[model samples]
Target chain A: MDYSKMCPKFESAAELLGKKWTGLIIRVLMGGPKRFKDIKEQIPDMSDKMLTDRMKELESLGVVKRTVYPEMPVRIEYELTEKGRDLEEVTNSIQAWGEKWM
Target chain B: MDYSKMCPKFESAAELLGKKWTGLIIRVLMGGPKRFKDIKEQIPDMSDKMLTDRMKELESLGVVKRTVYPEMPVRIEYELTEKGRDLEEVTNSIQAWGEKWM
Candidate 1:
């Protein structure tokens, strides 16, 4: 949690982003903000509990922002903040590598 | 294993690299080829079993190559492949992000 003491930056960042569903969650959000169900639609295999947990982690990291709209049927949406958008390059690079290697 | 079937690139790459300690292992190797003990020295908290397992996975993924010397004691070293070097940008990006955020 205390990444400041974690020495190398890549090591801390990787530890934070290298969780099972964390990358996928960020990739899906890269498409822009989405409602909870929409995110679920993209990663169908992820269980509701796992999604919630990943979202919480991302939210805590300031990568994802949660917004609620007061409506007849409460609406909730999750979007990447400015900090999260900085990872666009990282997402793109990993995707390119995966295409060529994996 | 079949990342092609996984759709998005980030999802597959993350699944492959997102496991615990995988990122740290790659970061250590980025300093150039290193013996197993040297790599272990960089990440003192990682268990031998986990390090061995991560090395095996990276080897299988072709990101890392294992070589054994024919000399007396048979020295072993792990080096990143050409394909692995392509990840330099990703590593840099994550490190920058970690420095700025986490």
Candidate 2:
């Protein structure tokens, strides 16, 4: 989507991260690809519905990838795309900022 | 407060910026000190009550400062404290991260 044209006129850069849960989701993804339960384990407070919704949103946004392995239980895993991996710097910055301000 | 000891166990940094509106408020304050109206102008979607609450939260957190000038109109301005300004780097990182992920 041409997010630049979106109303409220946030910079394309700002609009993406402005959404709720996106940052925290990305932060957890930093630890590496994990199954649905692994991600869920990391964020016990986030309901399964919310986590699924955020994962879909992140995937649609082109920052996260979902992989399903052909197993009896059909294991599913999530990892950052190359583009998503680039977000590490910003995450570090956020962690740093949170340290000082939060 | 000794936020580090708070339950749910967020890093001290994450605890601060993780709050709703705190990040956006800091993002706006990056432009410089702003009056109540000025800040509101920058974020028309935010209600007055919410903005007031966020300012108080940030001030008490020691990341933002409120200055009241005894003028006819009774101007009250808000700015980032030194610790607050340090958040700029983190903000920049968030902006950068948002660019890739969102």
lDDT of 1 at B90: 73
DockQ versus reference, model 1: 0.49
Expressed as tens digits, the lDDT of each residue in B9-88 for candidate 2 is 22455556656666677778887888888777766777999999989988887888999999997888999999888877
Best by lDDT: 1
Report the lDDT of model 2 for residue A70.
96
Scored against the true structure, residue A2 in model 2 reaches a CA lDDT of 24
Backbone clashes in model 2, listed as residue pairs: A16-B102, A98-B13, A99-B13, A102-B16
- How much is A32 displaced in model 2, in angstroms? 1.4
Native-contact recovery for every candidate?
A: 0.64, 0.27
Output the number of the TM-score-best candidate.
Answer: 1
The model with the greatest DockQ is: 1
